[model samples]
Target: TVQALLRESDNYIPQVEKIKYEVGNGTFVDDGGIYIRWINDIVRYGMYASKTFQRRDILGVYSGLVTRQLTDLEYAWEFNYLVDVKDEEDKKIRVCIDAKHMGNYMRFANHRDTNQNGDQLYVVYNDLWHVLYIAQAEIKLHEQIFVNYGQGYWENKKKYDF
Candidate 1:
């Protein structure tokens, strides 16, 4: 039902300011800039904080192509980047953002079975849905940004041997 898929409108442009980070010793020292690093051979890549971030700090936006379709190629691995979200309406509709091809560094954030350091918030602006990351705990420098991707995602991963 590609016809049912809605295209995002560019008419509503939000005036977002760029976040600045203080560099010290070749790394971000303040405001907690984030970066992607190699976690391990199994986990592959993961996101890390450059500085300390207190609980409830706004980390960043989880930007990507909003879609609902899961193609065969995506099912093999890109499926891991698919995140479910709710629309802004009286009756919410479940949708997902495919971050495989198009997304910011937030896509590198890894999943944690326990002790999640970050949480996702579905915020609505001008009827458009956006995923914002909030620090659930005190995230220190060089710490992994762990998010609970939920049980549903794990179950799907197991089915595909991902």
Candidate 2:
């Protein structure tokens, strides 16, 4: 459904073309191992923003946590490091979007983790700006992690009613 909406959007062509060019030039990976490709393209083309950070690095951190590859000691160490590195003053990051103007179709959900913790996430159909912004912000925790891969985050075994 999201793919279909994207295909229907006039802006989708240029965005996809830019992604193809980037992948072809080796500036971006084409293997589809990470959803960051789609996110980055959204930010770069859809939002008209410059590349502010490396998506791959951020994803590596998420992979470590999600896969339980980080040992207790490692996790503690990283947690401390992150706390120390976090902004001490005015630690808010703001994202402003005119949804109506953008003409974006977005969806949200909630579900439960394997451990039964509640998580909430969102999705956008054809709106690269919203999709990528949410993804990047979630990856950095500048905003909450609202999406997991292509699926919505789960909370309490029940998906959020959109």
Worst 10 residues of 1 by lDDT: 8-17
Q: In terms of TM-score, how similar is model 1 to the real structure? A: 0.65
**For candidate 2, lDDT tens digit of each residue in 1-162?**
445544443443444456547857889653322221133322221111122223312221111122212333211112221122223485533222222222211211112133211121112334322122222332322211232312221222334332
All candidates' lDDT scores?
A: 0.62, 0.27
Tell me each candidate's TM-score. Answer: 0.65, 0.23
The runs of at least 3 residues in candidate 1 whose Cα sits more than 4 Å from the true structure, single-residue gaps closed, are 1-32, 71-94, 159-162
Segments of candidate 2 deviating more than 4 angstroms: 1-8, 29-141, 148-162
Candidate 1's residue-wise lDDT over 119-147, tens digit each?
86554455565666778999999998988
**Clash count, candidate 2:** 10
Score residue 80 of candidate 1 by CA lDDT. Answer: 23
TM-score of the candidate numbered 2? 0.23
